[model samples]
Target: MPQNQPTNKIQNPETSVPKTPEMNERDFLNDMLTTEKYMTGSYNVALNEASNQTLYQDLATIFKETQDCQRNLYNLMFKNGWYAVDQAEQPKVQNAYQQFSGYKNQLPYAVQ
Candidate 1:
């Protein structure tokens, strides 16, 4: 292992905005993103517990729309540099792949 590993981050230049007690564009978008996430989770639970086929289908459609909205909001935020993620190290990613690969043999159905 190398003593020093360079950290990688994915981000863009953030749009400038004044910081104040009042909500700004970033704050509003952040709040909407959070709400969308919560709504998606709720819809997922509702879909799982839905008993009627029609209701399940309706909820599924709504869930997909909500998920899409969430993704768009996330993309917007990321583009504005409001959302940043660290790039995974290659060795760690390979280790995770190897660990999960072993579990494939335990699955009931064959993977092909």
Candidate 2:
């Protein structure tokens, strides 16, 4: 039986405690998928804060590619039953859409 060790001394139900032995595919994919998420976020930030138009476009393209990669990884994980995704409630989704669309056309932010 695999031992389920909590990441910290106190087990947090909301967070995952990765359990993979012999460096399994689930472990590799989870780590790569997670790291790609961070990379995508960094690319998005660079795109938003880029003072140079060329740099901004380059980052935007890279961000899109990273996003596609993340999606593919996620799909694979999901298909293999290695990833658990919780669907958002329709009301919650509607509320978020209303909130965000309220700021439509607003500049992402003032460039520093």
Candidate 2 lDDT (Cα, whole model)? 0.77
To one decimal, what is the Cα RMSD in angstroms of model 2 from the true structure?
9.6
Pairs of residues clashing in candidate 1: none
- Candidate 1 lDDT over residue span 32-56, tens digit each: 9999999999999999899999999
Clashing pairs in 2: none
- Report backbone clashes per prediction: 0, 0
lDDT of 1 at 3: 56
Give me the candidate number with maximum lDDT.
1
TM-score of 2: 0.62
Error of 2 at 95 (Å): 6.0
lDDT of 2 at 28: 84
lDDT of 1: 0.92
